[model samples]
Target: MFDMENTTVLDRPMLDELVPSRYALKIGEIDVLVISDGVLPLPTTMLAHNAEPAVREAWLNDMYLPKDAFDWALNVMVARSGGRTILIDAGLGLDPDLQLPRAGQLMKRLEAAGVNLGSVTDLVLTHMHMDHIGGLLVDGVKRQLRPDLQIHVSAAEVEFWRSPDFSRTAMPPGFPDALRATANHFMEEYGSHLRTFESSHEVAPGVVVRRTGGHTPGHSVVRLASGGEGLTFAGDAVFAVGFEQPNWHNGFEHDPEEAARVRIDLLRELAESGEMLVATHLPFPSVCRVAAEGEVFRWVPVFWDY
Candidate 1:
């Protein structure tokens, strides 16, 4: 019963000026800001894995999403606690050659939002994916953009990318080399400040890391608790469509089956607990609550503040 003729697709132009660069929210005493690093236009083919073309069109139509492409916002979180500035992900770096247009603006946006990048004390990486870790470097070098920042990542994730087997395994074109390069760079440049953890660990007071390990070998999520409020920073754990249809895996997932499984479980938990979610690749602001309906879930975006 989907109405194709009534479906309205997103037609907004992709530009940094068109959308607000940052959004702020609070969870307990911790101050959180969702910083924009720019957006990427990805083909719908990258989503809805294993679904028929007709089914894919129907799903997109129902959601009022463009059948041709989707705008994926590269959202990075800045968590301030006890005077310490903690960045969840480094975001895509500012390399014209390496990043696409309108991307790699995290630092600029942060500055505009009154965040002092020099004061960033800790950098917690959800995973070593290019988009997430790209901002770690400066001008394609391995040097830390913030000299005082200590890097934290999952031990398993670090080991996976650094292993010889990872280099041998086939990956999307140029991805293996890119991963190896970044992994080696991090170890060489930030080894002294790098800390690795297994499973769950507390990065700061009321901020915890949970190992998810479906999108990547060491993929994880961060939970922020304050007073009685909670928010989950889900890094590439679920995209927009993936949020509604947890069973439909993205082509970019390291293990599609495992990713789908983890997503379904996490979505159900979030819905039942009523925890707000900050997704990296969802729409602008990228803050939402997962609403469970039968087997599927829906993304209920937080209301805009004027």
Candidate 2:
């Protein structure tokens, strides 16, 4: 039995899950909690559209991953700084059309972790992707949240979703439609409450979110610095394969070329700074650092501190 009853898991009653769903760490004086929204299984082709089938298969085989679809880790973050609670990127809510039941666990997991929606003073979205903002659309979630919740997102992101261009993307048959509809719905529900920014904004002391459009027109990444420690919650700007193959284009990128450029730049920057990183679709608790070896980069997951 995987019992956490006598563990340091925030002292909440966990259900269904046998392992910890949240990982807590600190940066300076800021409190950071990396929560597992859950794993989203998607087709392998979606990972690298620009690479040849043989090369992609070889990489997957080297990692011991299946040749077919695999689970992509969906992670979100909660930050406490300046006496404010901030939620970064909500997780994938229920999507009957997507048939992805493994995801959308954020709501329940958050509650189990002793996080109350009403306590979230601010929300920062990296972009308006359905998976990133879907948790808000979950029934009754809105009612549970505080009325004056400030949702910070880039102005460019909101405008792009108005008539999102999927022509450049390489999503599955129904993916584009689902993304479009979900983004539209998210705006419909939370548009009026959005706190739009142009380039960068300090949501709270020691926490900054900056636009780094690549995967999406308004893609953004959040950075936290305090007490000489820094960490970046790199939304979709980086991925599991991003470090090793920064040039490979993910199928979800609207402008894959720009996305590749963005990935390469960000990886190089992180490698130099040695700041920690956590991405949306990286493995759960994707707390890792970037290491450079000449042209390519490496992913060094931080040792778990349970």
Candidate 3:
């Protein structure tokens, strides 16, 4: 069984201070802001789910990350266009009892940026996982962080997450507590703004949603374009520098093979189209340029002065 009884509140001092070089980037007429919610402490064994021992080991070594400690970064993206503000995903909320201090800093960063969370017009949830939806609710009262912001989710994702079979599917045992709580919070407090879209739907004028299921039954990716340049917000499809190697499949994916295929195909398409890729877990300030190197790929960090 999983150890899921901790109710410790996360504070600023318990978070690690690992900020990405790029804090914000402007594409066309839109402003894309990146904020870190902190990182997850996962084990290396979690990445080799279906892979052979040797194969997984080799991939781990190639990535240069610790084979024993596989911690992943969690970042949130905020976009502004034509007087509209949208948040890509909610960050992991505060865990006050944890040692990490920097978690739950998105609100502070937004305040510093002069953007109010309450004024956000829309919230595009890529998936319903804890790291992505934990911040969706306010602590204690079970209320949405932005009660007025419209919430857009793929129809399939909503159906899968709310389905009776969700518990039977391959999920972390602790998934129910947080995810179910988030679902309930949304249903009760913010159901008015909840909107579900079908495949390849548009959430806004320039914001397009595409189905990229793998990590979850109905995972979706957001594509934004303004002025002329294109920017794609890949929720959890590419975590960290793993986007550089499209074939590198982490164990977090519910369907490793399908995830690998989506990653590889996305890398190829993004490489050719020259669209800026936004990685929710690719180090905070999580926007980068991807390049194809033979059969593999590489990440070129986009430097912003902050």
Please provide, for model 2 over 120-169, each residue's C-alpha lDDT reduced to its tens digit, 9 standing for 90 to 100. Answer: 99999998888999999999999999999999999999999988898888
Error of 1 at 178 (Å): 3.2
Candidate 1 regions exceeding 4 Å error are: 1-18, 140-148, 164-172
User: Local distance difference test, per candidate?
Assistant: 0.78, 0.89, 0.69
Better of 1 and 3 by lDDT: 1
Can you give the TM-score per candidate against the true fold? 0.87, 0.95, 0.81
- Per-model C-alpha RMSD: 7.8, 3.0, 7.3
Which portions of model 3 show Cα errors greater than 4 Å? 1-22, 95-102, 140-147, 164-181
The TM-score that candidate 3 achieves is 0.81
Task: Report how far off residue 76 is in candidate 2 (Å).
Answer: 0.3
Ranking by lDDT: 2, 1, 3
Best by lDDT: 2
lDDT of 3: 0.69
The residue-by-residue lDDT of candidate 3 on 91-113, one tens digit each, is 77665543445455555555445
Of the pair 1 and 2, which is ahead by TM-score?
2
